[model samples]
Target: MRPSASVAALLLALIVPAAALAQAAPCDGGSVFEDRNGNGRRDAGEPGLQGQRVSDGERIVVSDAQGRYRLPLRDNRSQFLIKPAGYRLANRASGLPDYWLNVRLQAGPALKYGGMPVATSCRDYGLIPERRKAAGDLDVLVFADPQTKTATDVDYYRRDIVEPLLADRLAGRRVADLGLSLGDITHDDLSLYPKLNAVTASLEVPWLHAPGNHDLDFDATRDEDSLLSFRHVYGPDTFAWEEAQANFVVLDDVVYQPGSKADYIGGLRPDQFAFLESYLAGVSRQRLLVLAMHIPLFDAAPGRETFRRADRERLFGLLKDFPNLLVLSGHSHTQRHVFHDAASGWQGAKPLHEYNVGAACGAFWSGVKDAQGIPDTTMSDGTPNGYARLSVRADAGYGLRWFPARQSDSDKVANPYLRLYLPKVLRRGSYPSRGVFANVYMGREDSRVEYRLDDGDWKPMRRVEQPDPAVLAENARDDETERLRGYDRAATATPSAHLWNAPLPTDAAAGEHKVEVRVFDPWQGEQRMSASYRLLDTAQD
Candidate 1:
């Protein structure tokens, strides 16, 4: 479970996950898998990923206005192919795109899209303070690995995503004053940074970047040019910047500590650590210490170890004194939030909420064509490819709403895709593994939920009444699950989003199925979402 190119290439060379592949319809395109931001679901906005080319040997296509693309491969290819030169793929987590991907092809044509999350396009960085004692309302934009392997990838991000963000700024939204890229901005092309920054200049924001494995020189006779090219483009590797509300501390954790430059881990070297300490010396305790690293402090399922124990401990020690420390990281492009509950996390009392933001590239932008024939770049975890806007509220509360690329084109603030409703699960209690659990949010409590599994009978999930503590405490806690659970629930912005609990009758034969659930709200038409789960081997019959 790691996000590395070698692992991806190796997995592609070996196991093409059956779950991620599908059959095909002849030259109908060998099952092109692209980010179909159509239907206002996950399209790109100012920073759209346009002009990406997808081919499966027989078919070829490009991205469109919806930040979508399509392609068809001839023969028995199980997966729709990805063109690696100009544009690599993206890996998204909970709701943010990072550096991993999951793709499905049409019909029997199978394609295996695998890899560790790359800190290429989606990234992190410390904000360089522009003013002191100034208006405290500060908002920083975080872009993870875009992994522009070629000029096209850059163009895609420029047209599909960044340009829209610029438009948002023009619209008076107070777009983030500062910008930070996670890593892998350039895919081995040390020469791409200046041009990349040039396009990023569209936002009219001062930006900072981190180096990823792809951005490094794998084979250098000497270490002088380790990140020499990077320094030439974005300046020092590890440093601090200031915004009004938060004191940003960035660390270059991509130190190739073990193998020269070719093979390294997500680790920070002595010099980088020293820079962090030196930067912290001047930071005040009241100011939030936001550590933005290219690699995740934790991980997603396929996302493997990046930030190790020693580094976690070291970083924890560094920020332990500060009461407000926010860790913004990406690498595991699986959008999920892990709040350092008192039970699980690195250290300290305050919950360290780390986000495994999904990829803008959506599993390397791999998948079959949708109604528009563009790649359905929804990641394996089911998160659609998209960017995230993190607003650090003036009240010291962080407010985040992940905007699907498709949403920027429309004016509706909340769409059906953004709602979540789960059933009541016993608080602090475990349920029988085989029992059925329900999550329903049908706008109103009276709306119904219809469920079906692999030709199984349609089942009705009953709505039960119960007191929801999390729901009640949401708005009360700035850093509560409300800001974070959006990924798990897709929508339902308010605390009334999700309600989950298991029923006694949820047993089945040990097998797999397409469990599809559709909920209808009074305002919107019926909305459908699906999840696949294998019956636990130890499940009680």
Candidate 2:
């Protein structure tokens, strides 16, 4: 990412404080205590609540002695903030927000937020990989960048998003799947993780964690410097597991790399790279690969509003091999779709799709207020605070749906296909000899779609009949055949009448007009999606 002049100047200022004064060093975590009633400082009875919790996004844990705690301790993105209870924070000197401990320890070590303290590896600490399988049919309550500066800010997450999804994430949604906070768990306070988790767990789903840059060791000098306390508590940062028709790989790529002044870098470590390669070797091509991380691959090239080209290119090079890759990332805080194509790869097929899940925090956790006076929580790119769902099939296909927090019914469809047609006019010369092409993958086969155009009334787009008689007879003879295997309802082996070649309304005029495609599933009850396009004049009209 290109460096911002303003940010560079600010760092320079931080490195060289305007007025230098020696400050008192508090306890293990720090001395940033809440006054509860906004008093001057901590006093008797208003003790800094002990045993508080903290998180980065992927991990969760309680505070330790001295009223401080580290979360998902081992994750590289472990930027911990104190989880303050019954209190809140104004902001930090970073101007980035509240105080967060950047674990990329290069700055040095700290009993507090000054820098990262080194320790023997987990092997040296007796920690090892615990062969664990995440719960089944798991409902994961994923919150991306819940960066809150004040308690009021936390309420927005608690009221608008979390409160509504509580029932679903706990039982109604996936039933057994757990919930996860993607990153930027809190604005800054390593202290905030606990208070946040306390409120989040009220939904009744166990929360996994991941750290974010905002949650990092701000005092770090080098990239390797990190919040060792996070590792000591949670497990390691990189890990894997299998579920339904997919295998999940959660990576910790937000490594604050070493730079001239002090900036964060994104990358995969040598050990993590090895770990991923090993995980990939055993997975079958038939299964879907879901790679979840905080940063997006090149920010999906979302105009110039994304990450640096070099970073994206580097990330793409690292993980473009798999046949079935579905990346779920959310760094830019916007919902974006990125596509990558490799001439030749192991699985051998079409290019890959990377989806950048907007944000649960939305726009660094700032925006307009809702009825509850909480900011609207809209993401920087105008997407609402929401989560995504992927329904996997017995076969190699999956259906994705995005749900906006403000809606009751699933009627909100965010990713409607953008329909593009070739040749404004269907001239006799260009018309396909086979008629026309119609792809019926309107999200799902069972979806009910009604269509209309400049003057024609709304009519349904039906899923017509399947195989030819001869082929059906042939398949009846053999229980297992390639043709039979590919002829399932979702997979059409042979084609017939085309949907794209609907007669261009013989009664229609030749002026510019509109063609509307309305799609919905009565079965889903509400979440119907629609798309519209312009129609050019018909040469022969």
Candidate 3:
């Protein structure tokens, strides 16, 4: 039936306004602006930052001339900024960088550990202008596998690792410009995220983290839902950041298979590759491209594939154009370097370098406790518990140095580069079969190691494939005892990648002789250490 003009007009007005409201309200969007007053809000007079890049995990969009951007709403995903050089994001009170916004679901997956929280309206990002040094000066603090299992483990990390670094910062010493934790932030207990973040935040640097196997939600039935807790706490599991020296990408390489026998494998998802292909195309090849992840790209053991080979080939193909590349990973707990060539599907201009960093909680914080109530926690490969310092320079060059957790001030010969083991006494004029061993912490297969006795001619030390004698000795001690050494016994020794051996010349003299050892470190120049051993006459013995 035909209605009157007034009734039809009223119906048209009601339907039209409702449709307009539905279209006008956007689910995801915000403005990138210069926070002139240092506050995180965009007040009057604050200008929008033009040409800034924002991403919704897969797709990237540039801010318009007015510094505004809008992306299609992605359910249960995160949007992050590709921070530009010379500008910095303000850190949250928890010391996490304010670079990402969470687009969460009203009701996320119900997991054993409480899943993600409801969505928040935190799209607006405030950037502060920072005067950075010329092209390539950057320093980063690198930590791996601080996999604390309980409150006590957290306390150990706080006292053993964080306190020393915090002391340096408190004393007005220079700290790293950026910090990275390569995963296993917690040991299966997702609730410890806040406590761990608090300790790391005390460093006062912008920190980024990769997801490790331990940082998973076991109740999820699929790989896609594995990192719900991680994303909730740490934002996007895959994202990128930029500096004058390098373009950094953090990827979630751990692929969970809820019901599979293998449980999980190391590989990138298609979405991660999509983001990489889109973003890397625009990235300048002149700058270093640094990829950080929890699992390594290379296989852990021969003939056994740890990471998916097809995914690695695709990733390498995307990275072929970049000349300067570095890959950082941490999952093995022990440290080593791997170079990928053509055989490994790396067809770059040169071999690809991967540094598998040592764990901060070495051997899961196991071993006898010291006087400070901290575990010794030396790794099975004989690498002491420590962190890495990465220095980048202007010419696309970088340097890496490892610092052990405990440094002794009173020892006459205190060198952090390597640890030495030698017998205190030997029979004079014997067959000279006993040898001195050195564990060069950062040593490579091609490293040049030499030793000199009593300041005599320097003799070369041969690299050996064996367990570190020092660690083996400690293992023996633990085995000979019945009582519990600590929370756990030290890990049994494994063949080290950097152990060197040299025969001691007991035939030289009957008195004490000083042995000096040195190695030419590719990054840290020359490092030296000294120890003394005595030779006794048969009658005197």
Candidate 4:
């Protein structure tokens, strides 16, 4: 029907304001409904989960009896159901862990690299009923930086890493309880997200993923939009869940900014800090606090700040109230245990332990192929490409053990718990610049490492910071090999954090001698390992 201009002006005034109000409607919080049938979706009969806390990365609110809650959201954000002690969020058919919902009022500009495909409004979560177990005393497998770049690399991860973990049932522990991927789950190739999820699903466990620098959306113009794809795939980048008698806080510490190219720095967003402080305020100080992220909270090397000091200091301040704390990170492919205490600005009474675990994609899947066609991706720190098993006690005490990618019957018997390195050949009774080296993979500062010469008395091995000779040799092999050995050579060898050295015994005759090394790990079980060293009387030669 046609209308006069005066009548049309009145209609426009009425309709325009109504439409704008609808657009501004609140959706900051959503329902956490119960899916009794385990279908992973909210159906008609499903009831709402009440009294649970949900956060939108800034403020937290408790779900009412009807399971409805509201958050103060000013813009696009993610809201997650902090899996309470007695419940768990449902898993997706895509195999990716799903716990949160993205709340977007409207779509942003179309990105050159394609940001989130569509804006989501109602962020509802569905969960299957399950009784919560005390996660206080549990074993968890942590895989750092699988970083599968290509589809082929995904296959490599499936066959080489996932298959073994499944075959072993994560070293005979419960796989469904807890497992974590420190970060860098994919190598920039977001398409492989499904493949990685499928591989992780085989463990049949609840896995938490933290987004790394490579997981950011490169085309996003602002730092806040950098993780659109990641959130789209893995839910909230900053969320906390309590289980295993501890609080597991997963954060997206990678800050991406576009420059001549896309560059990233390690720091936490201001909002995330506020979210952390708010969430922790309600948490009991008795529980163990485990902070899991991609980039470490402190620098890996001296004078080189891998993380922002101001942000780290801020985080440290927030953690001051918690006495039981542990930090787990995986960015550097190498593995080492770092202690953050007063010297590092950590205000906790006890020094905080940060485990910079090794990568599952050792050396980025580099090195020569083996009989199974798997690349021998030994880490630059001389730690083999593998994973770690964290043993958490009900009281929050914990210990860690590193598992090499490959293990054989002989290896299981010889050095099942440690690694010993020694020179293959040495001149008898002559000046030896480099001596026997032992890489007690799990040794710490207070560890006792001693060596004995073929039934001789045990002698202590001095701890030294140096590049592992074996790792150096592995790199040299790729460099000197005439044939192409791998997609890329191992990263230039770096000084290992746990290396012990001792001078070869000159009393031994010019013959083949076995140098046996025994180590007493402060945390792991005792280990005994040996390697044969040849002494050639240079004068006779």
Best by TM-score: 3
Better lDDT candidate (2, 4): 4
For model 3 the local lDDT of residue 444 reads 85
Ten-residue stretch with the least lDDT total in model 4: 407-416
Q: What digit string (tens of lDDT, one per residue) describes model 1 on residues 1-541? A: 6869977767764665443333332233112223333221232332334543333222335556543544432222212222222222232221221221122222221112111111112111111112234455555677776666667656666765577677777887656656777777766776666577777776765566666666665453233345545543444456555554666656667755435443656766655565556556655666566677777766322345556657767876776666776777666544555565434345576767665455665444444434633344444433455676566644445644455545563646634243332322322223444333343422234556667766567676655444233333332343444444322222112222233333332355555545566666433466666655554345335
* Each candidate's clash count: 111, 56, 0, 4
Q: By descending lDDT, how would the candidates be arranged? A: 3, 4, 1, 2
> lDDT per residue, candidate 4, 117-170, as tens digits?
555566677766666556446677788999988987888788777776675575
**lDDT of candidate model 1 versus the reference:** 0.50
* Model 3 stretches astray by more than 4 angstroms: 1-29, 120-122, 132-136, 408-413, 539-541
lDDT of 2 by residue, 1-541 (tens): 9669989867766865543212111124343344454333455555444444344433434544444443322323443333221233332222121324433323235535433344312110001111334322323445567766667667767876677766655555532244555566666666565566666656654345566666665565555555343333333455554444566666666777545443655566666565555445555666676677776655333353234455445555555555667776766665655555552221235667666665776654444344566554444333456766555543546555556664544434433222222234433333332211123222343445555665468776554433322223333544455443221211112432112223334234444445555556322333323333333443653
Best by lDDT: 3
Give the winner by lDDT: 1 or 2: 1
Output the TM-score of candidate 2. Answer: 0.53
| 10 residues in a row with least lDDT, candidate 3 | 19-28
* Two-way lDDT contest, 2 vs 3, winner: 3
Error of 4 at 433 (Å): 3.6
lDDT (Cα atoms) of all candidates against the true structure: 0.50, 0.48, 0.87, 0.79
Write the number of the candidate with greater lDDT, choosing between 1 and 3.
3
**Tens digits of per-residue lDDT for model 3, 1-541:** 9989989968967866855433223545588999877677888999998999999788898888878988655666788989987788887766798888777646777997876777746477788888666554789989999999999999988888788788668989756788999999999999998999999998888899999999999889888889988887888999999888888999999999887889999999888999999999898777788999999998988888899999999999999878899999999988888889998999988999898899999999999998989999999988889888888886779988888875522335457689899999999988888889999988987899999999999999999989988889999999899988888999889988889999998778689999999999999899899999999888743
